[model samples]
Structure formats: C-alpha cells, structure tokens
Target: MTPLECVELQLAAYNERNLKLFLTAFAENVRCYRLPDMVLTIDGKAALGEFYAANRFVHEGLHAKLLNRMVVGNKVIDHELIHGLGPEPMETSVVFVIEDGLIAQVFFIPAKSPS
Candidate 1:
C-alpha cells in the first residue's frame, strides 16, 4: 500500500478502535513516538495494544480529518483535525514512516492554534 493509504488505514483503525486493523497496519517491531517526549517509545504490537487499551477510552469516536498530506518516499506527514469528546477539538500533525507496506514509526505533534 502507498504511504498515504497506509496512514489512512492507521487513522481509520484508530478511530474505529479496531485493534486488529491497527496492529495489521504496523510492522511487528513498530516504534511510535510522541512529541516533547522523545524517550517514550511503544515498541512491538503487544506493547502498543496495552497502551491502546489504557487510553482508547479517551478517544471514543475520535477521527482524524486530514487537511494536508505531504509524501516523501516512505514517509507521510499529515495535518489533521481530531474530532471527539473533549472540551474542544484538536489539531495535530502526524508523521508516519512506512516500510514494506507497514508503518515502521509514527510521530505526533500538537498543532499550534491561531492566537
């Protein structure tokens, strides 16, 4: 699958809370990182699964609507808005690295709001 398609699948899986789909879209030893917290790495599907289970409740019905996507080889960067149950909607940038049709790594950054 193309990088964009892989990212779309990943986002869909996350929105739907489908652990199988989420796991399938990622490599066996995938590493996910969150911005401002470089040392936090979720390695392997089982560890990712545990993390998802713990935080999934906060994201019920959460979905990402991509506003822009830039692709450079196996990497895709997405500017998106996340809609879900929260005080306010969120905007973020997601960087995905795809290898052999599976996501090898993902990085997230909180989008700055207009002042």
Candidate 2:
C-alpha cells in the first residue's frame, strides 16, 4: 500500500477500535514520538498494540475526524480532531513515515501540549 493508503486504513481501524487491523499498517519496529521534544511514546508493534488495547480501544466513544491530509514523499501528514479520550475534542497533527509500505515512525503534535 502507499503511505497515504496505509495511514487512511490505520485511521479507519483506529476509529473502529480494531486493534488487529490497526496494527497491520505499522512496521514491526515502528517507533512513535511526541513532536517538539521528540519524546518516544510507543516503541515496536507489540507496544503499539498494547498501548491501543489498554488505553484507547476500550473507549467505545473513541473516534477521530480527519480535518486535513497531505502527502510528501513517503510521509503522510494528517490533521485530526479526536474524541472519547476526554470531555472535549482534541486537535492534533500526526506525521506518519512509511517504509516498504508500512509505517515505520510516527510523530504526534497536539494542539495544546504533549499527549
């Protein structure tokens, strides 16, 4: 799949809370970081699955609305409005780096602070 396709598929899987499907778009050694400070948040596919299963997928109301999307080289950048994690919606920008058609690294930038 293309980088944009991988990202879109994962976004769908995430909003549907489908842990297995969500993980397919990622590489085994995937790394996730919070932007600005580039703090490592999730490392590897196992940890990624665990983080979603334990912290995110459980929320029945969890959903993300894609506000905008841009593609450059092997990267897909998405601006999204997220819900179900808290009382108010959260706006964030996520940068996905694809390698060999799988997401290898991700950087998340929250509108307010680190997430």
What TM-score, over all chains together, does every model reach? 0.82, 0.97
Alpha-carbon runs more than 4 Å astray in model 2:
none
Query: Candidate 1 lDDT (Cα, whole model)?
Result: 0.81
Q: How many Å off is the CA of 66 in candidate 2?
A: 0.2
Model 2 scores worst on lDDT over the 10 consecutive residues at: 106-115
Candidate 2 collision pairs: none
Off by over 4 Å in 1: 112-115
| Alpha-carbon RMSD of each model | 3.0, 1.2
In the range 28-114, model 2's lDDT, one tens digit per residue, is 999999988989999999999999999999999999999999999999999999999999999999999999999999999999974
What is candidate 2's TM-score against the reference? 0.97
Best by the TM-score measure: 2
Tens digit of lDDT per residue, candidate 1, span 28-83?
88888878666556888788888887766357767767799999999999999887
